[model samples]
Target: MNGMLPWAISFALIAVALAMIFAAIRLLRGPAAEDRVLALDTLYVNGMILVLTLGIQFGSRFYFDIALLIALFGFVGSAAMAKFLLRGEVIEP
Candidate 1:
């Protein structure tokens, strides 16, 4: 298990990077605002996963903290965008 850890991490990083790239393409080529928003959300999620995988590879707590921040901000941003799409406003007036 230990011997395969590095290979696993490398694979995860590559997979997440590919996912991020695909999400970016969708964000740019999406025909609708909702598709763009969903792509953006996917990009952030992949980013967070990439960071967590790096944390595992390096055995650093700092990466975990950064991943947590990414998850928190990504969730909030996605929620705000969804709310705005549904009601035309992120905050109630």
Candidate 2:
């Protein structure tokens, strides 16, 4: 029973890693600005999930903090990019 959890986490980690790779490729190769932005968002989410699972697998609270930071930064970056795309700028005067 104890062995299955680790195996599951390992599999999930690998899956998330693969997702991140694909998202990176999309970000680099996407032809449109919106596509690139979407890819960037996906990449950040996959990374955050990966870190969270790693934290669980390793039983450490430090990774949790890292995951939280990732979430915060990723959301802000994505929002800024979207705003720039929509309004030609990220900040308003």
Candidate 3:
């Protein structure tokens, strides 16, 4: 069971990495700012998931902290981008 776990995680990590790469391509080639932002958000999410999968595969807790930080920053950045798109500015002042 233990040996199987690492293999499963490795597969999942590879899948997520592929998805993130696709998302990055979309972000770069997107025709609109909104599309780029959405792709970037997707990339961030996939990256966090990949981090968690790595943590599981290696039996380490270190990646979890990095994942949490990535998620936090991703959320904040997405929110700011959305606000700017909707109102033309991220902050009123």
Q: Each model's TM-score?
A: 0.94, 0.95, 0.91
Which window of ten consecutive residues has the lowest lDDT sum in model 1? 1-10
* lDDT assessment of candidate 1: 0.93
What's the ranking of the predictions by TM-score, best on top? 2, 1, 3
Tell me the tens digit of each residue's lDDT in model 2 across 1-93. Answer: 569999999999999999999999999999999999999999998999999999999999999999899999999999999999999999999
| lDDT for 31 (candidate 1) | 99
Model 2 reaches what TM-score against the true structure? 0.95
lDDT of candidate 3 vs native? 0.93
Candidate 1, residue 83: Cα displacement in angstroms equals: 0.8
Expressed as tens digits, the lDDT of each residue in 8-30 for candidate 3 is 88799889999999999999999
Error at 66, model 1, angstroms: 0.6
Which whole-number lDDT from 0 to 100 does residue 61 have in model 3?
A: 92
**Distance from true location, Cα of 89 in model 1, Å:** 1.0
- 1-93: candidate 1 lDDT, tens digit per residue: 468889888898999999999999999999999999999999998999999998898899999899999999999999999999999999997
In terms of TM-score, which candidate is stronger, 2 or 3? 2
By lDDT rank, best first, the candidates go 2, 1, 3
lDDT of each: 0.93, 0.95, 0.93
